[model samples]
Target: MVKIGVLALQGAVREHVRSVEASGAEAVVVKRKEQLDEIDGLILPGGESTTMRRLIDKYDFFDALKNFGTQGKPIFGTCAGLILLASDIVGQESAHLQLMDMKVERNAFGRQVDSFEAALEVKGIAEDFEAVFIRAPYVVEVGEDVEVLAVVNNNIVAAKQGQYLCSAFHPELTDDHRMTAYFVEMVEAAKKELAS
Candidate 1:
């Protein structure tokens, strides 16, 4: 089976692991660079971006992740994870891998009180997914190859760059598995090519 990892340094690690298993893949917690090497893809769970960055720096896993992405491994980032995947960020100063070609504004929806759920029309998802936004970020701009998948109030909140998918909401916290299923398809495709 293809192995997928959850960046377990912080955030909704268990939820992501369960979601990965529900999607028919092996789920592993990736706290170190060595753990990352064994996985075919990764999921950056929702959490405080600053804290996650601190852990990334402390663990010395930033460059290793950048290297992994450069090699074309897939990554799915949610909420704060979306912030890390974006190539640019606004509002607060934070460390990022500068991967996706998008500009994101941290806490774009206001304070924690602003957190709410909305039925979102996301690309590749057959039905509306209940998007749970908790201090989420939204994309202000996207590069040529980055496809905007979903938007809320005209602000981009979901996007995909090649195999790297990102959402400014916590999909792991919901019961819906469409996004997880889509990601699993990505893993399977990647595994197929590798096997070939």
Candidate 2:
């Protein structure tokens, strides 16, 4: 069975774990760097980017998390998690993980009171997924390797680059498992390649 790790730093940890398990994968809450060695894939859940970044560094998980990406394992990041994966952050001095090749604007949508939901037509999935946005960041630009997955109101909200999958909305908050299933499939494929 494929084991997926959810960074339990400061975000929706349990929500992601439930969603991942619902998608047919074993989910583990990753708090320490040693735990990274046991997972097939990782999920960076929705939360405050600043807090997550601080916890990551405080726990000494900064470099280990980045190295995990280089190993070719699929990493699924949602909302603030998406911000961490971006290579560049507009109007922000520093980026978190900087794993994905894209530029993101933190809180591009608006404040907390402006949070909203929408039905998004994502690539690779036939049906539309309901996206929950909470102070979500929008992707301003993507590198050559990045593939835009879903757009809302002319703003890029979801994208994938290599093993990195990101969304500016929180999919785990809803019951829909399509997006999580898509990522689980990516994890399975990577595991297969490693075995071969």
Candidate 3:
């Protein structure tokens, strides 16, 4: 089975693991950067971006994570994860990982009290995807190669760029496994391509 690692440095780790298994793939809680070598793909779960970044650096995962993506391994970033993958973050001096070619704004959706769920029409994925957003960040702009997957209120909420995928909402928070399954498919395809 395809093994998908959920970065356990921060939030929604258990939820993502459950979602990944529900999607028919083996899920691994990746606490150490060395575990990256054991998984076919990685999921950076929703969390406080700054804190997660600190943990990532403290554990010396910053480089390994970037190398994993650069090697063509599929990566799925949710919420803060999306922020980490972005090439640029508004008002930030620099970005983390910088794997995806996009610009994101932190907490573009307002505070925690303003969190809400929306029915999204994720392109090429689902006609109606129930998305859960908590202080979410949206894509402000994307490179020409980025494929916008879902938009909400004129804000880009989900997108795919090459082997990288991101969503401003937490798919694992809901029972919907389609998004996770789609990522599993991406990992499987990439693994096959690598093997060949």
Candidate that would win on lDDT = 3
Q: Write the per-residue lDDT of candidate 1 for residues 1-196, one digit (tens) a residue.
A: 8899999988999999888999889999897798878999999899998899889999999999898788778899999999988878876555398889889999999889999999999987745899999999899999999998998999998899987999998888887878887888887887687668
Give a tens-digit lDDT track for model 2, residues 18-58.
99999999999998999999999999998999898989999
Q: Candidate 3 local accuracy as lDDT?
A: 0.97
Instruction: Show where candidate 2 strays beyond 4 Å.
Output: none
Q: Stretches of candidate 3 above 4 Å error?
A: none
Model 1 stretches with alpha carbons more than 4 Å out:
91-95
Model 3 over residues 1-196: C-alpha lDDT tens digits?
Answer: 9999999998999999999999999999999989999999999999999999999999999999999999999999999999999999999999998999999999999999999999999998899899999999999999999999999999999999999999999999999999999999999999999899
Give the TM-score comparing model 1 with the true structure, all chains together. 0.96
Ten-residue segment with the worst summed lDDT in candidate 1?
A: 86-95
- For residue 184, give model 3's deviation from the true position in Å: 0.4
Candidate 1, overall lDDT? 0.88
